[model samples]
Target chain A: MFTRNPAGLAALLTFVLSAAMVFAQAPNLGKPVSPAEIAAWDINVLPDGSGLPPGSGTPADGARIYTAKCSACHGPEGKGGPSARLVGGEPVKNMSSEKTIAGFWPYSTTLFDYIRRAMPWQQPRSLTNEEVYALTAYILSQNQLIGERDAMNAQTLPKVRMPNRDGFIVRFPDRTP
Target chain B: MNKTPSDRIKRELTDLQAVAGNGLLHRRALLRGGAALAGAMTGYTLLPSALGQQLTDDAWSRVPGSTVPDYGSRSRFEKDVVRTLSNPKGEPRTQHARTPHHLINGTFTPNGLHFVISHAGDPDIEPDKHRLVIHGLVKQPLVFTLDTLARYPMVSRMAFVECGGNSAPLFSPQPIQASVQALHGLVSCSEWTGVPLSTLLDEAGIDPKAKWLIAEGGDSPHLSRSVPLSKAMDDAMIALYQNGERIMPGNGYPMRLLLPGWEGNMNTKWVRRIQLTEGPGMTFYESRTYAAILPGGKAYQFYFMQEVKSFITHPSPGLAMKGPGFYEISGIAYSGYGRIAKVMVSADGGKSWAQAALQEPVHSKAFTRFRAPWRWDGGPAVLQSRAWDEAGYAQPTRTQLVAARGETAQVPPVTAFPSQHYNAIVSWSVERGGEVKHVYA
Candidate 1:
């Protein structure tokens, strides 16, 4: 599928040959990526609970994990200390209180995805799948969206309706004029 | 220090005034003193002389002794440095630098002065070690090194990438007293050269059910964004060159996704992988940050396009008008939807507007320079520019914007975060003494 002009081809050939002579080796442009290799890097989770790893955790377990890992940045009660607040605020429509995940986030899956990929601020992606699930459950419980003993898994997590689930407008109509 | 070009011009003007006679110079000096006194009596805060001196013509002049031997460097005299803002901790690793828009003219923004907003730190990637992998729901998963990717057919286009938070401070109830660049400098235009993303997707043979593509970067935090398949196949490109040169390190060196006219955050820098997906990735960037919080509590998610916007660059704050006789009012206009069809300039606070001359080669989804000739009568006036795009969207006034969105109280410690798409008509109030200030008219 790759097409190059004659001049470009000539330039590439010259570059490859000269570089090979200097290093005494021909460069391997690239190899076909295998499915296993793709699995190693495919970490994204969708709104529909796709790409979620097989794991489960209770909110009680999540509270302890959050205290040890996330409380430093998110605050003891998830009311925001230095980083973003995870709970306790009105939806963005009120415009009176600060926006928190409980008040503003529309999808619960984002909480799991973000925590798995870029949470803890200092050491990201170091959490196990169970730890991620526990943290997600703890944050949601603190938001009062779920009970303390509720077990969160791929199935239960996607079913939890956030307070701002219907608070988002997807159609960005051109309001220019 | 050697005298700058502007300093020399000012010296020559002073010499001419001296050679002419004492009468004219004396009268002019008296008038200036009286104006300053009047401004002082009216309690109008004046810009510091030191700051005003920096805004001299030298700020807009090309760098002296600059050469393009193999690489390019800005002129030594050019002092349009990017202004930065960081968190209270004073960490330099994570900070945002605003472009000096007021100091620059024309559409092309210099590479050095381009605004930078990094969530984590910029990554250091070696081109030879970098690899782009396309996988997931594709017939053939392919991985290509930089050299192999460079062999694809190339295309070039001029476009603007604006931060979703560009002009976000305008949402503040109280007007922010700052230069135009400090206020709305996050957006910049450039000539980008790359291979169309469709070519690679076609080569990989995308699945019929794949509706979204998750583009991930190699930067720390591994910044990622989900792009629709339609946009990916439409105008998306794997940019390798910026402004006729290899992409700068801060701007995704070896390769980056170029989503023309989309929010700058969506243009993932240091791009590493593209995974064809069946749904939105629902990353933090899309769901939490960069989402616009509208009035009545409904936040607008995944709003990508930056609407039509324009600003008056010359005669803005910092560049004090020298008597304001015959001035060429010049500014830039751009649209995310399409080309700028018309730009109207008004000197009387939108009372009446005259169509400005649109610069040639007005490319779609790019910055188009506009100019108009105006003779100030040494009176108070407000200068404003309104842009219209081919989509028939005209820039709205601040009042209209606030009305459409909800108005927040202009109280101290204001923090009513509005939507990210703020393209209201900006007005600059000019005093009789030639001082200008940003105003909402």
Candidate 2:
């Protein structure tokens, strides 16, 4: 199971052989699973938002509702309090500090999807699309990413520019490059 | 310095006089004593001078630690090293247990009492019947039992794994007496033996289109997570052994995935299946538990990798020191990327930095220790430390992080960060009264 490649195969075989040559090695143990059972278990989100459900929210509707339910732990402005901070600030402060949502969030759809599902701290999945949109608007407005009057529909929300939109550093670039 | 009955009583009185804020010690003195790192110089514990005596008899030839027991456990001298806080309600959720931070010293956290954050509590699994399946966006779907995995050659890594919510209370200005382990012991490092994800993916014959992979747990709630294909291909692994033993039941007994430097939530425990996928699992734990809420009310997407950060566990608030004498300054530093190249200790906050000694055999993506001999003066002074990973990423400051990431109406997303990542420095002022307090300015 662990040895997947042919190159690794030779190494593994040599290792198992040497171990056998040493301790006469014990018998194999542990049962395997059925194939069909595995197909039933696979699930994960995608970069293209493939796993995202069919739903959209506007920032206008997200603001009012968010202030009442989320303003406490996340702070009235979204900077953060005792819980995790969710919005505003320059994404990475001086290249070292990767803080703030308005500064770091890569995609806008995550806003709608995240609120529609997990939120309110105490009660998850309690907010509707309209409330989520208003809250989103309020948060973005607070971050200065969007204006107070701006209605963050599906189109406008995606267009919203985050400071770190193109700033993500690709890992191990020079090592392989 | 052995404390007399009166002296012990006097110390206890001083401890009671200590105030608390936001679950943290208002004064660094609150951290001293029966507290972790407390009284290093002032004398909470000292190796008996008798330990340094020379032996001329055959007893000198005796192998030290020859009395080692079969089962490795915390030192009896450090008996209080157990989880200080636990879910009082018990089964209300996962069997969440806090680490005994004050009791444990050094960079690595032993597995026995490592903080546990399971979704539906721990599951009792029969290792013999366990199975691991690899399918999804893979050319050749694969299924392996515990036996098949054991056949594969394994590699070991001494690295740290931390929960995203470690030290969640540190965000507040008030000191929270909740205990240091409860505040920051969610992280621990060990010698993890396993097969690399690249090897597993090669075996699974993953499809090129695979952008994500779903890792499912064998436990009751079946805690599952979606890891980025890039990270999986880069440094992910299927760990079978921890420390020197088969993975303990409290840990992922049969097996658990170790996502180097990634958030604890994603390294699904009791790993059952790893399905190569084109999308995320969107498990309740993800969409509901780990997701972050924004200022306006909307939440953000997943940022799984934990950034570079470190803390000076020693001389932290609550511990007391001997009166103005020599003390060994030490602490552990680890990164999700690689080894910590250099650790700079600042006695004057972050204003200036001085080099600290890096412990030998500094392993990559693992905890490396740093130490220095400190000559303390019985007066006011602030102490702090900062770490730079091998990749040249220096720990940031709290003010800098806050300025970069502003306040929001909703709980900001803690995808990449479980707690504040501003590793700028934590300072404690040693007052003339021999008192230490957490200071900001």
What lDDT tens digits, residue by residue, belong to model 1 across residues B207-311? 999998999988767788988899899999999999988887878888999999888999999999999998878788888777777777787778888889999
Candidate fnat values, all: 0.58, 0.07
Q: Write out the backbone clash pairs for model 1.
A: A93-B297, B63-B75
Chain B TM-score, model 2, reads 0.78
Tens digits of lDDT, candidate 1, A38-129: 77677888888888889899888988888898888778988878777787887665333366788888889988988887766667778999
> DockQ of all candidates, in order?
0.32, 0.07
Off by over 4 Å in 2: A1-35, A39-177, B1-75, B175-179, B292-300, B406-424
Candidate of highest lDDT: 1
Best by DockQ: 1
Question: What tens-digit string does per-residue lDDT give for candidate 2 at A1-177?
Answer: 555678888888999899876653323222334555553453333334443333444455666676778877777767777555777555443322434566656555455545544466456546655566677667777777777688765556657666545544333222210
Q: What's the lDDT of the predicted structure labeled candidate 1?
A: 0.77
Query: Which ten residues in a row are the worst by lDDT in model 1 chain B?
Result: B18-27
